[model samples]
Target: MTAYLPMDREERREMLASVGVDLDHLFDSIQESQKLKKTDFSGLQQEGISELEVVERLTALADLNKRTDDYDSYLGAGFYDHYQPAAVNHLISRTEFLTAYTPYQAEISQGTLQAIFEWQSYISRLSGMDVSNASLYDGASAAAEAALMACREKRLYKVFVSAGMHPEYIETIETYCHAAGVEVEVGALNEAGKTAEFPTEKGYAAYMVQSPNFYGVVEDLPLLVEKAHATGALAGASCDLISLALLQRPGDLGVDIVTGEAQALGIPMSFGGPGVGYMAVTQKLLRKMPGRIAGETVDRDGKTSYVLTIQAREQHIRRERATSNICTAQALMATSATIWLALMGSSGIRDVAEQSAAKALYLQEKLLATGLFENTYDSPVFREFALTAKGSLDLYKLNQDLLAEKIFGGLVVDDNRWLLAVTEKKSKQAMDKFVETVVRLAQAQ
Candidate 1:
């Protein structure tokens, strides 16, 4: 058998000797009281199994998971259930793209750099912004980072976020702001499902709102932006990228920073993870944007090339001076989103957005027809909406009943209100079955 460490006894001895101590001698300085004679990993150590046996065990464990493919799912809060094109996986899985790391050296990393550049361009065009960073961790972090950027750019310590934003995103912003010594204030949502009140004082750095927010209601962004501007604060929004296809661009509404989860683009809802977060800003805020930005240039040989430009991450510069402390970009995931956008083009994306909206409306109509559920808010919505079950039919019980029918129901947002989402991937027959199941559950109650 090959030695895992790649060192023979003699070589190991020589290395330890050069370090001026043997393994035991190296640990001689440790206090006897703090040292352990034997490592006790109780209950965690398992008996060794053969390779085939291990595979079988893992397969058995994996089979316990309720996969989306086998069940009807309406679960979309941030992560979605869009159909990823086969070509997206095929192209992204290529060795050159999949295994590529940060493209620090432009000469040897042209392919990766170009891919990132394209990703940035796609996001910029979709967002109607002057520029976009390579990518961030996820929607929550991107929103948090955007708040920080706003604070830095406007030179203010206070930020105002709408109560309509995703709860998780709000919590994340609070954590990031607390650490940065910035103040975060959440404004209330009005009857029209829009952020209503704003501080009359002119000390806020930015006003952040989410359209098709956690409740899936489209906020009045134009009016919101105007209010922010009146207070001399930048308007930032955490948006749903797919919804942007059918709605007015935040940039066109006078927003300074647009950040959103790109999961609905082409990425899967792989158990709520590995989704790319995109951040785009007006030209003036480009330098303060977080993460890597790829730029097109000419090589010494006069050939077009791509390179990392405007990297404001802490690793590349002084920590205090860095615009953001995000260590890396979501290169692979961003590439997936880029490929999805390229494949879909503008028309395809619009078609998807339209289909999702139509389906959601259809579901809403179907549920309301049965008199089992009613709309919680009367506002323009895109692919998702909130509904309240009539009578004593609890959302948790309904979800459990749905599980029995091999269907996953909408997420429970409030006490009897459920947030349901519809994607283009859901078929008419499937939606009908889901509606039938809900109707039956309602009747049972």
Candidate 2:
């Protein structure tokens, strides 16, 4: 007796018949005995809780939890809240954009292909790389997949990853390569927050590192890339796309592959994902890249047309030799990014990046001004940094107090330090509020 959309026995039977299947086929992929075993549990039915009752119950539960209006978020190890233009969302959410799938049919999907082509061009220019794919699942997958591309050659038994690379991404790569039986080596960070180790003696496939890495410190690219290349290993960089507006481009830094999250551009941080990952590589490495790629050409009418180019990805070629198992791309999100960049243009994007950098510095200065916190790393960063507070205050408790002030504090880096993220969304007033709240909490302690 399910309260929601309960189907009568006859209706259920008709549903199964309409699908041209029986109950067994519905559970065909799973072991049949495991299909809602009758003896496993008790089924209880209350005569459907009233809508009002449900709302009141939820409200009561919420009331037990504290509410805060002063939320100043410092929780950006990766995703930051950047101001998205209204037009970006409005254009990307149209039914045609939202509901579309991969444009495998060139004749019917010119518009979608054009949008992807624009996205590719924008990403290529931004990364200072040659070609760009339509999009990947997210940054972590793109990083791991890029590693595979870099390390897939014979005689390359090992890959080196930077310690500053986001831990989750490292885990993802390890998981993917472990199944493939490839060994992974981790490079330790130097005191200046850059990758310092190089496996020059041992032959390897690639070195994977992140710029403005997990600790929010920028790593030395040219020297690190040179080191990897000196060992005959490909250099792959994972970076925050927004930061690229002001930082040295990956191509200029001699990176062979660049992959990173595009969520910061205009996509809202939907709590870890539903965002797009962008992967760009030098023309030399394009054949090894994964995901769908759009290319420009002329149609039969001699008018401009766009089609899925570099047909070596999972969706376009033989399953075994395909560069990836990914069949679906983040079509709508890529469109969002295209719209975002088109609206912002080059100068606007740079302005946003500059403002974010300035805001982060302002917050750092204010936090240091309190004389109650210290920087954990000494390096140039884009928008986030670590702040170590005096005394062993419980970060969870401090967070609770800050929430009461409606301020979201930074991530808890450790027992004594917290990682705070400042973006263009944060203003001087917001920084002041956070600083004041932290100072008050410190004084009380």
lDDT of 2 by residue, 204-278 (tens): 888889998998898888977889888888888998988899999998888999999888887877656788888
Q: At residue 431, what lDDT does model 2 achieve?
A: 75
**Model 1, range 123-178, lDDT digits (tens) per residue?**
88888899998899999999999999999998999999999999999999999999
TM-score of 1: 0.92
Clashes of 1: 0
**RMSD vs true structure, all candidates:** 3.1, 3.7
Backbone clash tally (model 2) = 10
List candidate 1 stretches off by more than 4 Å.
Answer: 1-47, 312-317
Say which candidate scores most in lDDT.
Answer: 1
